[model samples]
Target: MKQVEVTLNVNGKDTTLTIPPRMTLVDCLRDELRLTGTHVGCEHGICGACSVFLDDEPIRSCLMFAVQAAGHRITTVEGLLNEDGSLSDLQDSFWECHAMQCGYCTPGMLVASESLLAENPDPSEDDIREAISGNLCRCTGYQQIVEAVQMTAKRRREGAANG
Candidate 1:
């Protein structure tokens, strides 16, 4: 296989790498970029563990070729962190609400939840459920995840109102 040079804008930084055309975006991010936050569970896109933001929209990185991601902005789970290197509100909420167990699905859950919150500042429980439906978690039973999103939304709204 011939290697191709691809420039991907990830976590607001542009990086160029020479990689095989068939390499999946998840593999590229983990292996080349050393962004191991995006976990590889099902590799087949069904697990949603490899979710990341492609141009600010949630996508399964496992389903996308590295070459295909060229010229697109990618935000891995690490991108959701605060600029000061602290946890974002959503991440904090996940921790406070105990939304994860074993932690395999956390990256995808955070990406999906953050994407949902970005679009809908105040989402109902059903809306959160619908938004995260694609990601599966065997532990935590999902109630805690929903609570985490709700907690983040309420905090953000409150902060906005106070500020």
Candidate 2:
């Protein structure tokens, strides 16, 4: 079996790994790096459960190969933590708003929401819906998720104004 070396900057850590060419990024993250936050569902990329950040952009890890991720910055849900290692503002908002159920899609939802918030700090309801369209949540009907993002945005704005 032929193997390839790929280097990925994950969660602010530099990691070099050797793996088979056919291995998917999701596999490398979960199997090798032990970042299980990125789930695997609908391996065809429709479920959006395996979403991760490639250079701050939400991408489906299951649809991408490990080799293709080389030299890229990957951020799994584990990376979304405050300096004190507690939940981030967005994560806290999710909890406060009860944005998760079963927790399978939470990670992907977080990634998608983070991407949206990064690009648009003050996202409208429609914007929040469109941002999470790719990630499927059969649990909360998505209303709570949208509310979570909205809450996070509001809190962030307040914090910025006060700080």
Each candidate's TM vs. the true structure?
A: 0.97, 0.96
Q: Which pairs clash in model 1?
A: none
Which portions of model 1 miss their true places by more than 4 Å?
A: none
Q: How does model 2 fare in lDDT? A: 0.91
Which sections of candidate 2 miss by over 4 Å?
A: none
Q: Please write out the lDDT profile of model 1 over residues 16-87, one tens digit for every residue.
A: 899999999999999999999999989998988999999999999999999999888999999999999999
Q: Residue-wise lDDT of candidate 2 within 1-163, one digit each (tens)?
A: 8998888889999898999999999999999999988898888899888999998889999999989988889999999988889999999989998888788899999999999999998999999999999999867559888999999999888888999
Note the Cα lDDT for every prediction shown.
0.94, 0.91
Please provide the root mean square deviation of candidate 2 (C-alpha atoms, Å): 1.0
Error of 2 at 22 (Å): 0.8
Cα lDDT over the full model 1:
0.94
Which candidate gets the maximum lDDT versus the true structure?
Answer: 1
